[model samples]
Each structure stands twice: as C-alpha cells, then as structure tokens.
Target: MLRTDYKPQSIRQSGQLLQRHSSRGFRWAFTGTIIGILLVILSFNSGSLADSHASQLSTEKNKISAEPAQQQLSADKAKASIKKLPRMNIELPPDTDGRLSQDQTDIADEYENAFPRRALPLSIETSLYDESADDENPNTLTAVTVQAGDSLARIFQKQSIPARDLQNIMSLGKPVKALTKMMPGTVIEFVRDRQNTLIQIRYPLDETDTLIIDKKASGYHSKIDQVKVETELVSVNGVINDSLFLSGKAAGLSDNLIMQLAGIFGWDIDFVLDIRKGDRFTVVYEKRYAAGEFLGNGAIVAAEFVNQGKSFRAVQFVDDKGNRNYFTPEGYSMRKAFLRAPLNFLYVSSGFKRKRFHPILKRVKAHRGIDYRAPKGTPVYAAGDGKVIRSGYNKYNGNYVFIKHGEKYVTKYLHFSRRKVRTGQRVKQGQTIGYVGMTGLAEAPHLHYEFLVNGVHRNPRTVKLPQARPIDKKHRTLFTASTRSLIARLDLEDRIYLAQLDRINRQQAALSNSEISPKSAPQ
Candidate 1:
C-alpha cells in the first residue's frame, strides 16, 4: 500500500533505472534488425551466384552433348572392327548323350562367369597321347605310376574315377585280380572319352602281357593281351682271375645268369673246391625283347667251361617230345645220377677220413662223412631222387635223414635243425630235404653228409657217380642238326675272345718294351 512516508528519491531512481533498461532494449532491437538486413542481403547475393553457376552448368552440358555423339561414332567403329575380325568357328566334341553332365555344366558356368562378354568354347583334352593314335586305342590316355603304399581303390579315388567302375572292373574276378597286387612304379593308363568318362584302362601284368579293361554297353570287360617276344642271340665270356661270381659280375653277368652258368657245369666241377685260377667260360644265350624293349636273359643255348686245363662244352637241345636237356658235342648228357655236392657249401670242415679228431667227442674217430661248414639254416638238398629210409634224431647226429637211392646207394644227411621228408617220402635231386643245424653232439652249425655204396661208406667227393642216359637215339640226329650252329657260334666267340686278349697282351707288351727301352741320347 502507498504511504505518505515513502521516499520520493528512491522512486525517482527507480524511474531512471526503468528508462535506462528501455533504452538498452531499443539499442539491442536496432542492432538485431541491422544484422537481419545484412543476412537477407547476403542470402540474395548467394541466390544470384547460384543462378550464375546453374547457367555455367547448362553451357557445359551443351558442350558435352557433342562428346556422346563422338563416343557413339567411336563405339560404332569398334563394333565394325570387331565384326571384321576372323570368327573362329570351333566345334566342340559331341557328347555321347548329346548333353553335358552336371559337373560339366558347372565347369561351363564358371567359364562363362570368367568371360562375361563372350565365352569361347573352352575345351581341354585331358589325354596326353598323340591325336593321331590308332583307332584301336584312339581315346587319349592318362598314365599314373603306382607309388608305394597306394592301393587300386586309392589310386582310382585320387584320379576322380567312379568307384562303381572300379567295382565293375573287379567283378571281372580272375582277369583283374592282379591289378590289386600292382607293384610300385607300375604304370596304369586310363582312357577317357570326350566327356572325361573312364572308357578304358590298361595295366601291364608282366613284360609281355597287359591287362586291358574296356567299358562296354553291358559292363567293363577285361582281357589280357600278350605282345610278341623276339629272341636275340648274345654271347658273354670271362676269364676267372678270382672267384667265378666276381669274374662273372666283372663280365656284366647278372646273378641269375651266373647261377645258371654254375648249374650247367656244376655236375662235373665242384664249384666249392674245384674252381681254380686261369679258368675261363663262354656263354651263348638268348636275350628276349618285346616292342623293342629288352625283357631279360633267356635260355642258355650253349656254354663252355674250361676247368683245370680241360675244356667242357654243352649245347642245349629240345627234343621232339618237348624235353629239354644240355648235351655235349658228342650227345652225352650233362646231368649225372647224383650231384657231386648235395648242397651249396662255403667250405669243408672235415673230409671223409679213416681217422680224425672229433671236436665234440675230443677223440680220434672215423670221419665217414664230409662235414660241410655253412651258415646255420643253409638248405641241404637231396643228393638224388630217392626214398627216405629214416628220418630221426640221435645224440651224435642231430636231425638226420637217410635216403635209399635204388638198391645200391644210400645217402645220409646229419646235424640238421629240421627234416622236410618223412620216413617214406621220395625226394628229387636238389630238393631241400633239411636245413643245417648243430642240434646234438656238436659245437657249431654244419651238415654232416655221408655217402654209402652197397652198405659201405665211401668218399662222396671221389666216388664214381652213375652216368645219366645220353640223348635218345631217335632224337640224336635232330639234336646234332639243331645244336651244330650253337656249338660253332660258341667256338667262334671263344676264338674271338682269345684273339682280343692276345691283341691286348701284345699291346701291353709293346708298351712295356717301349717304356723299358733306353731313350735316344740327345746329341
């Protein structure tokens, strides 16, 4: 409420303050109005600048309008050049069903995506064979060498071949069973048609036979085809300065060939005892081939072994009855009724003697048999075709086998670890009757072999062995006619070898003489 006592000075000051606030408000409103007007003018100028920029953009658009036509002309010229290019008309191989498989379709889709503008008919023939191959096997083949630890199923899986086809091939039973036993490094060829479908397979069974599996309308059919093998005559000769094996190896003879050589002359010469230095041998043999590739060494047509200054030659003859045997130039058989040594031995521990000191008994005793010292488990062969009379064990003789050869001769093998024949089994010559062992009353592994003639012990090494029958009288003429050239070739090869040796010796002697001769004194 208003009272008379209120101070008028305070009221006047309040009025002055109100006046000042009113003036400040007016000044702020004037400043805001000026700023608004400036903003409007700037906005108007920005609109004019935008209009000028729009007009410049319209003129640039008009200038670029002719570039589209020029670009169109260039594109037309490019199209014309593309049309003028040589069109390669490639014809893809037709499929059997006149359609692509799902896999082929997917591959084709990938090719199309890779080249979207124009996808050329891309064909990759998987065959590594020449296109000019014969019609019998016109389909290209991919060869794979079987690696170690790889099975046929694994190989087929690795090649992406259908398991059903492998099953069908195996269904052939006997013919394709050998495929499961393929050795490492065996080459298997797969022939696929244009569709990459397995059409044929070729697996070589041996040097001459190849197993071929062809996919037919019914199923896979398998067969073995043999190549024609040709036999070529070859000769090898060696002089024995050391052992026969070493000399033969030095002369480039394989182990098999060397063993064959030993077998041919083994009846007459004791390879363990009789082979001496200065001995020589000549072998005329056959080397087989199929399709220009060497197969292996074949039968020995003729051979000569000179032992202890005596020359022995044998020529092979196949009779009319298909029986093959080695015969001398005089038609005498090379085989005897009994082998000179029943087994391949390293050395003789004890010879047949009237009296000798026994290692086990430690006393002088009659050593009726020859003790052949060989490694334990060495095979002991039957000396001849004979029936076992006794096969038993004794304290003195370990595992013993006694065989009766006809009515006159008996052979006994002792100190064997085991016996192969029973009491009545007939054994052939060179048949392994038992292995060597010292089972009883012995110190080391050895075979004690004894020869009995008419119930009396004889020296097996020096005994007169019964002679084998000569070539049959009926085939004698045929044998002579067939083996004449072989003997001649053998002799000729020997003479040529001797001549070469003589020439070499002469050259060596001449060199030695020249070396030893005094050089001409310089004047």
Candidate 2:
C-alpha cells in the first residue's frame, strides 16, 4: 500500500550503513532486502510508480513554459472590458499654420495630464482662453509706422481706429498735439481689445524717451517715460580736406553735431565766408548709451578749432543756476552778442556794395545791405538781443522788422512773408522774428539785411559785433573748477596724436638703423 519513496541514493546509502551496523544480523538485513525487492517488483508492474516519476520529471523540465491558465483568462476579460468602453474623437481648434501655438500647446499639455484618457470629459476647450492669461487687457500691441504724406487722422482711419477717439485725444491740447506732427519713420504702438477700443498708446519721443497714453476711468492720461541713458566722453580730430561739413562727417560726427560744432565757433569764424583749407578741429563731446545700446550723440563738451592758423579752445560748463554754456579757459563766453547770419540762408545773393542797380527800382542806387537768398518761409532770426523798434508793411520793403540794439546799433530785416514780433517787443538774440519772402520791391525770395551805426548804413558782414557777457565774477570759481578736467580732455587729443607720431618716428628710426647696420657691417 506504500507509495514510491523517490530518494534512491539516500535509500541505498541507508542500506549500506545498515549492513555495516548490523553485520551479525545479515540474515535480518537479507530478509528485509528480499522483502523490498518483492515490493519493488510489485510496484513496477503497477503503473502508479512510473506515472509519479514521469510527473516529477515533466514539471522540472517544463518549469519555464508552465503557468496558471486562470491568470491569462482574466487578462483577456480585462481587454474585452476596455474595448467595450466608449471611443471619443475630440475636435481641436484650427491652428494658423497646422501646428499649435505656445498657448495651445500649454493648454493641451494641461488637459492631457489633468484627466485620464478613458475618463475624458465630453469636451475640453482652450480657444476661448486669453493668450496672455495674466495680463488684464490681454490685447496685442499693433504697430503703425508713419509713411510719407501720412497724417495722424489718416493713419487712425486706415487702421480702423475711431475718429472720435483721436478728437478726444487732440482735445487735451498742445502736449497731445505733438503726435499729429510726427515725421515719417516714426512708429506708434496701440493696444486694443477685441472690440478695438484703444487701451493704450506709445510714441517714441526720442531714442530714450517714450510718450505713453493710457485709458483711465476718468479720461485719457498721458505721461513721458525717460529711460536712463549713460553718458560717455568722446573725442574726434579732423582736418579740413574740402569742406567743413564733409570733414565733420569724416570725423564721424552726425549732421546735428556738425551744425552744433559750427555754431560753437560760428561767432568768431564764419563757416561760409571764413573757413579755409588746412583748417583743423578737435571736438570732445558726449556719447549717450542705454543698456549697452548706442542711443545717439549729445552736446559738445569741449572743442578746439584752429582757423587760419589761429587756435581757439572752448569748454562747456554749467553755472550754479544750472545754466549750461561754452567758454574759453580764461572764462570768456563763446557766444557773441550777434550771430553772423540771422537765417541759415543758401548764400549771400547780393553783398553789401557802395553802388548797384536795384532789381526792383531798375535804377542805380547804393545797395547798403547784404541780401540773403533763401527758400520762402525760411525763418529769419534777430541778429542781436534788442527791442523791436519798427514792425510794419511798406511799399518799398514788404514786411520789415527793425531792432535797435542799445543806442549805437540798429538792425533792419526786409521782405518777409510773415512777421512774428510786434513793435516795442523785447526779443532775445537768434529769436525768429519773420519768414523770408518776395514781397514788394523784391524780385525773388531774399532777406535784405542791413546794419546801421548812428543811423548810417554799414556793411552787415564787416561790422564789429559786440561781445557777449563774460563769466560773472561771482561764478568764476565754479566755472573754473568745472572746466579744468574738460580742458584736459580736450588736450588729450593732441597728446594722443603726438604719441602716435612719436611711435611712427621711432619705428622709422629703427628701420633706418637696421638698414645702416647691414651696409656698415665688417667685410
């Protein structure tokens, strides 16, 4: 009835140990072996022992392939259950270029992560969300560049902006009126909502200044925002090759800075009449910057102009009153009492002569003053600070303005298209008093300027001009202390030039020495 005990080696070893221990009891061990042999013979005939052995061998050999069928059946049931679930085909909003924008991508990522795919909601939408969710206005800034012949009203109309809004903005007066006169290439930015109501506007006043206008609860409010710009000292040395303007351009000075340079020395040296070849100049000025970007050039800090072998140096200084002006090292004002030419005219059409035939009178008469030909509407300025003694119309002289500078000098301007000053009005030097035009007694648009001394006509160009006020004694110390460093900076140009020349000379000397050494070597 005993089943198979499958430990054959242990059973054999146990039998040997029994034989060793029970050597005297061989009869009993032999009898037990005979009984075990008889039992094994009976078990071999019966198939139960062989079946148990085969089952053990088959399980050990097929261990990798063998698994419970119930687990696989459960997996199949799970797949079937998942397939029975509802399939969802969600439609997304059309993208501009067949690809999602950054906003859409962010929304998609959030939706994908927040809800499970199998348990997705009926629909998840992202199109209605604002592109800039954090911004209160959530409006895009639209840029409108001013083109030629474009007006503020025209731009607004072209962009479909409201005319009433422009009118309301203009009602704010002169400060807002500046936007109407923006030149071509100026860019104006407008921020508007979906309804196209202007939320904000920005116009660049200059490189570092932006005029900002925003819609407020009460009304529209405007303010100027100035970016911090760094100022750096710069210097340029240029010699006259052909013309002062060209030389200034070669020196890397812009047109505005060149005009400023000429103005600094214009009192003493006339750029048109007196500037000659070989004249040289050195300018130390300000270079402005903001956030490592070059904004533009600033004022002339100090300058030296050598005209006709005469050297003149001017240093820019600010007084205790915060008034800035250029002066010589000896504290003399660079500005003169009168400018050479009141208007920046094209040329002197007719020089002051003793006798000449009048173009309009058609008779030989003494032409006592210089006539400056310029475009109509060119602004004519006062030559010196004075009170307007006479301002009226005449048959011989169209629109005239006469200014009496003290008791000694009286200046007259004739043939103006318009007059800006009134009689007995005090006007500063260089103040625009009228515009050039061809009216009564003039064949063309020109300014007939006259300089009178003691009520007698004198040459406007050759007359000696009065000197401007010098540095006041009270402010001399402040001006002197401020100009020392600027003077040194001006002098640095010459020092640097001399150092370059010295370096070149030394290199030439070294080259000559090397050549002479080869020639004079021992043979």
Candidate 3:
C-alpha cells in the first residue's frame, strides 16, 4: 500500500465516498459507516414517537395531510427544540419479486410518518404578518328606545357607554344631530364589543332614512342610508250610506285618506252639508312601502265624487319643481279662491239674518255672519289668499281676524279661542288664523264666518268668489303627461267600481226576490 497522510473529508466528500468505497480505506470508514446507520434508524424511531405525541397533544388542532414546503422549512429551522422530521435515506424494499408496488402504500405510510406535520390553519388568510386586525369586535347589538325626558347624554349613560364617545360621534355633523333630536318611541341602535366600547350607532331619521355612525381607526364616521320607498297606486270606492267616514272605514280606507278625500272634493262639494245618501266616490291614492313593509299612504293621485247627480273629477299633478296640486282634466286648479267656511263646521248654529234675536244680548239685531257650530279649538282658516289687515278683540267680536284679499274682497273670522297669526302677515288661503271659541257676544263654541265683497257683507256659502290661479303655462305640458295616464286609469277604475256596484245591487235584488213571496197568489 502506498503511504498516504490522513486528511479529514468534508460532509460533501463523505457523502460521495459512501456511494463508492475502496478496500484499502475500509478500517477508517467502518466506524463512520456504523454511526451513520444508527443515526438513520434513530431518526425514524423518533419521528414515529413524535408523530404519536403530536397527535396526542394537538387533538383539537386542525390537521392537514400534506404540509406546505414553506412551513416544512420553518419546522426544520426550529428542529432543535421541536421534534426532528427529516427525510430518511433508506431504500424502500419492493413488495413482490422484481415488481414495485404500484399503489406504493408502504412508501406513503413511511412518508406520512417521516415528517412532523404542522397544524395548518383552517382559515384562508395564512399570512404571518397581518397586524392591523380590529381589536374590538362589536358583538352585542342593543336597541335603546327613547322615552319621555330622555336626552342623548342620558341615553348613552344608561347604556353604560362613555359620553365622550357620543360626543365624538356627534362631531361628525348635521346627520349626527338627528340622534340628539330623537323623539319619543324612536330607536337608537348601538354596537359594542366585549369590553363595552361602542363601535357603531344607527339613528332612524324617518321611515325612509337612517343615519349610521361607525367607529374607525382614525375617528368616527357617518353616512345616511336612505331607504327606497315604493309607491303603489291603490283604488278605493264606496257609497255614502250614513257618513263619508263610515263608508270610508268599511271600504278599508285610513282616516288620513278619508280626510284627504274630503279635502280633494271640498272645493266642489260641501262634505258636511252635501254628502247625502246615494253619493259615491272613487279614489286612486298612493300607498308607500319601504322594504316590502307598509309605511303609509302618500297622496291622492285621482279622485271622483258623484254628488247630487253631478260628477266632480280631480287629479293630483306634480310639476318639475316638485310642487303638487289638484286640478281638473282641463288644467283648472281644484282649489278655489276661498273656502266656503273658515273652519270645519259640525252644524249650522245660526244663519245670517237681518233681524235675529241675539241670545246673549237678548235683543234683535242684524247678524252679519253665518255662525258655524264646531268643537272649541277647531282650526279657523284664512278662507282666501290675503293679508291680515286687522287682528284684535272687541266687545262684539272677540279675537277677530279681518283679511283683505286684493282690494275687492275681504273675509273675517271671529270668536277664536287661540289666534295663530299676527296682523300684517301675508297669509295663504286655508291657512289657520285662529281656533274656534265662545267669545264676546257668542253663546257657544262656533266660528262666525263672513265673506265681504267691496266691504259689503255677503253670504259665505252662496257668494261667487274669485277663481284660483290655473296651472302655469310651462307646467301644462308636464301636468298633461303625468295626469293623462292617471286619468285613464281613474276612468277605468271608476267603470270597474260601477260594474261591481251594479253586480252587488243585482245580487241583492235576486236575494230580495228570493226572500219575498207572490202574496200567496192573491188568496
């Protein structure tokens, strides 16, 4: 053997030398060979034991069949403290003679045991560096109802929420002020975390609007969430048997709708004195809905009233400026120049007479105005678009209001319990000026209504007043377009209602015939 000085080989050289060996260097390599085999066997045994131990410890931890290469590398870096899961060098034996197992079940089993699988997260966000997550997760949702004498500060204090938070939220602006002005029975929603810090708030402005305030990392944020309301046209028809209110109720109409119906036809017909038996009306109105939930009726789209064999039709028209008013099909305004009576009357307590015995004075005098008996505090309207020329009290007419409608017309309202307007204030027709009351020279709560033409007292009920302004020329086109479809639908609905009424009458007639006998054949 040639003399050769021993030089230690590196790990790379040793790995290459293991693949091919020579007999001259067998002694020095024998110990290294035995130690490498022992290490390989110890690694497999430790892996098996570590696998069982990890499974025992992390029974509740999420498990995955295949570990990602990145995590496996991480596991390798931490192998000193953790269990070693390195791949082995042993060659897997064939299952059959010169034939490898196609299924490789044995190899798969060894591979599964060879590495320590990490408990993979079941979540998709597996990033190790996402530190901006919210610490306060609002979980508890509370809806605090506003009661009488409750302020926003008190509400927040009651909820155990910091008043500072409420102040911070209110700093967001006008939309947030809606919360501070919550009415009785309104709801204010709050979202808080486990630590009881308020994260969000919602204040409903109306049926179709809500103000939302949210807590962000920077500061409190707010936005208005306006809910879209659906408008559905609904038609209701009824015959006046006893009263319009009774008939409307039976026809499934709300008091608001019933009042609206009376108002629409009030210019043409006197609802108090003109609504009689055989009177029928058909109304197409707007029914509002928010998120499929009923909100309320909006406006009367079209209405038809047959009073005393005379049919009065009116359709609501909205112009481009969003101003809405009722008008006839010919574009004449349905609102007259003046209301027949300044206040709603229950009955005619006294008529205008030249020589009428005064109840309080016990003397005969010329009663200048018609006395309309109504409930005390009932509103008194202006009756015409005018200015308040005089508003004062007197011995004869207490709390009197005299309005000058142009130079030719004047209207007066007397015996007011409460005056709502001041003198020299320009007032519109139907504007409330005062409330009905029994004042000087009055025996009961009634409105003494008078209409004067050129300073001469005239009958408010039978006088021919000036006409209301017609629809503007620019709005005529839009009004015609909007009302055209509504008018057609109104007519169709009216016809359908008439047919239904006729069918009902026929059914009743047949029932009457069935109920009646032929007088026993005149026996």
Per TM-score, the best of the predicted structures is 3
- Alpha carbon lDDT at 447, candidate 2: 98
lDDT of 2: 0.84
Better of 1 and 2 by lDDT: 1
TM-score of each: 0.61, 0.62, 0.69
Q: In candidate 2, what are the lDDT values of residues 1-523, reduced to their tens digit?
A: 7658656888889998988878868878899999999999898776675575466545544632464433333456556745743343445576565677777687576445432343212333577765677767667789999999999899889878889888878887877777978999999999987667898889998888898988888888888899999999988998888888899999898999899888888888877777788788998889999999998889999999989989889999888888988888899898888888888777788999888987667889889999999999999999988999999999989999999999898999999999999999999988999999988799899999999989999897888887667899999888878888988887888788768768989999999988785456677
Supply the TM-score for candidate 3.
0.69
Cα misplacement distance, residue 438 of candidate 2 (Å): 4.9
Predictions in order: lDDT? 0.86, 0.84, 0.82
> 1-523, model 1: which lDDT tens digit per residue?
8897777998989989999999999999999999999999999998897676566556545544545542334456557745843343434457645666676676576444432342223335558656646555545779999999999999999999988887888888988889889999999999998678998899999889999999999888888899999999988889898889999999888899889888888889998789899899999888999889999998888999999989999999998878888989999999888888888788998899999998867899899989899889999999889999999998878799999999999999998998888999988988999999998887889888899999999999999989867888999889889999998898798889889989999999999998897879999
Q: What would the per-residue lDDT of candidate 3 be over residues 201-293, giving only the tens digit for each residue?
A: 888888888888889999999988998899999888888998888999998899999999888777777787777898888888999998889
Sorted by lDDT, highest first, which candidate order results? Answer: 1, 2, 3
**2 versus 3: better lDDT goes to:** 2
Give the candidate number with the greatest lDDT. 1
* Model 1: how far residue 410 lies from native, Å: 1.2
Count of backbone collisions in candidate 1: 0
